[model samples]
Target chain A: MSELIRDFARLPQTWFETPIAAIALTLAAYFVGVRLFKLMRHPSWFPPVVIAALLIAAVIALLPIGVEDYNRGAAWLTLLLGPATVALAVPLYQQLPQIRALWRPILMTLPLSATLAACYALLIAWAMGAPPEVLASLAPKSVTSPIALSLTEELGGSTALLMGALMVTGITAIFGVEWLSRWLKIRDPRLIGLALGINGHALGTVRAFEISHQAGAFASLGMSLTGAFTAVVLPVVWHLFV
Target chain B: MSIMRGLLWLLAFLLLGQSMVQLLPIPLPAGVVGMLLLTLWFVRRGKMNADVVAVSHPLIAMLALLIMPGVVEIFFVAGRYADQAGAILTALLVGTLLSVASSLWLMRRYMPPLNETDHE
Candidate 1:
């Protein structure tokens, strides 16, 4: 078994050289992860994204391929992020009447929540003795991945570390939001969705959709507005304070 | 075909958003600006087309998967920060929970009560 494992690892790198190989590997891993998630009854214990990422990570770790190579091959999928983000407006538009009615509250909540997200991350990380870069990365963890990555870049933080922090933040919001809402007696779908979107970003939006259309609409609204507010404000704040 | 049209709309808005970001003085993300632009267009039109809904549903559903590549980079990069992993994790957990709790608390306190017809 050890010899076989060594032989597999020593296989020619040419087989995995093409971008197709990378894309195929990602899709296969993600599908398998989704199957496992469903087989496990879709428990919050292992979200498909976490499973897929781990599987891909394991494969990349064992293979004789560099991170840059893998990322370059997978660039096509990442490029869709921008269009997908714009696609979010469909749901937001559906909920516009309600949003317009509550525009005052949402406008007020956006900056306040954005500030809280940045401050809580910075202060907690600072107290924990996190280095400056880690603190900067954490400051934008609550925003969507695309915007978060951009914010991290602007603030001179490590994009990879910010990605990890985001995964943690997203998973926590996915599993914890409901329990927290019940505990806090948050009954409104709008507020519940808003909390999840503000804290979890895209992952939280996915979970919010599972609850109801109304919840999903509000979640998209929260996610979009928070991303806008954070993207515009975080770099300036980071420069001034951190 | 309708999905294609819907995609075209998304792509167009994305381009417009990118142009706006480059032209405007404020530092805004193109994606968010595109979303806002689409929202305003939808508001002015007074209805959402089914084609946009058709395309957006699948896109949003698979949103998490689309971000996996970036997340996977963490595995490659996390080793450098191994010493600080515990601190990072602690901050993430505490900060996330606090942010969610505080946002929910504030929104509930300040937002007006929902109308009877709003329960949908």
Candidate 2:
């Protein structure tokens, strides 16, 4: 018993040793989780993000891995966002011909979608008797993270909630776009892009790629438009309500 | 011909965001502000093509998944929101319904049937 105790004591603490290695291991596990999710037919009930979350949770719980250690590695993946978001331009350009033809429809849809998203959140909150701050954060749920967070903070909503809401909104739209598009009979890539981008934020953009190159482009355009319109419109509406 | 020019246009849009983030009031985060600014650019330009359309898709697609890393921090803030989960869940459910319904309405309003477009 004493020997075993001594051997155990020799082991370094979670945060103390090989912090980078721990992060690398966690990220590796995340990659595996993503692959496994794909194998499971990318089941709607257990999405890639949800699966990743569960797998990461089990890892942290079962092992002595600290989050800080894991974050060090995973965060490097996040730095790709700036370039990736910019890269969406390639697909946007590819679909430009189709977009030009449907410019009239595209122009009208952005504001309508943005307005509905904002107003719907507000109306639902009012109906359910939610407080103003909650409504404020909810206001920007349909837009992307940066804008959603900004609006949440500005209206004194919980940034954390806004973040969570952003994730949920994005993920749902990611999965939800196909069904919505089919039901709506939307064939235009620009419209698909706009709807997903506006309504799904970033997540919809992800799903847009699975549909087609054009669909993906429109998703990017829509997302940017949604973010932009919501940023401006939400504030004007917030002032009116507050 | 203009496919390459679209690249320059995208660079301009991205830079416009970076520059304006510093200028915008109301503490709007720059990326979202940039996204908005980009939308205005699209509306103003009002032109599209295959190459032009393909430019931004992948970037946005990958970015959608970028939120995964942030979920780890949720544990830290989870406690503060525990009491309000009901409200949050309600907002999600209600908000989702409204989103789908509104999207459906808009699609019906603007888009003609695909077969009809081909016929025309």
Per-residue lDDT tens digits for candidate 1, residues A2-64, read 999877766636656777777888889899999999989987746898999999988888888
RMSD, one per candidate, in order: 3.0, 5.3
Candidate 2 TM-score versus the reference: 0.77
Candidate with best DockQ: 1
> TM-scores across all candidates?
0.92, 0.77
Poorest lDDT segment (10 consecutive residues) of candidate 1 chain B: B111-120
lDDT of 2 by residue, A61-123 (tens): 566656665566567767555545555545565566666666776677668877886676667
Tens digit per residue, CA lDDT, model 2, B1-120: 554655555566567767776765534554544445555556577644344455554445455356666665555566777766777766665676567557656865886644455443
**Candidate 1 global TM-score:** 0.92
- For residue B97, model 2's alpha carbon misses the true position, in angstroms, by 2.8
Place model 1 in a CAPRI quality band.
medium
Task: Give the lDDT of residue A208 in candidate 1.
Answer: 87
Would you give me the overall lDDT of model 2? Answer: 0.65
**Each model's number of backbone clashes?**
0, 40
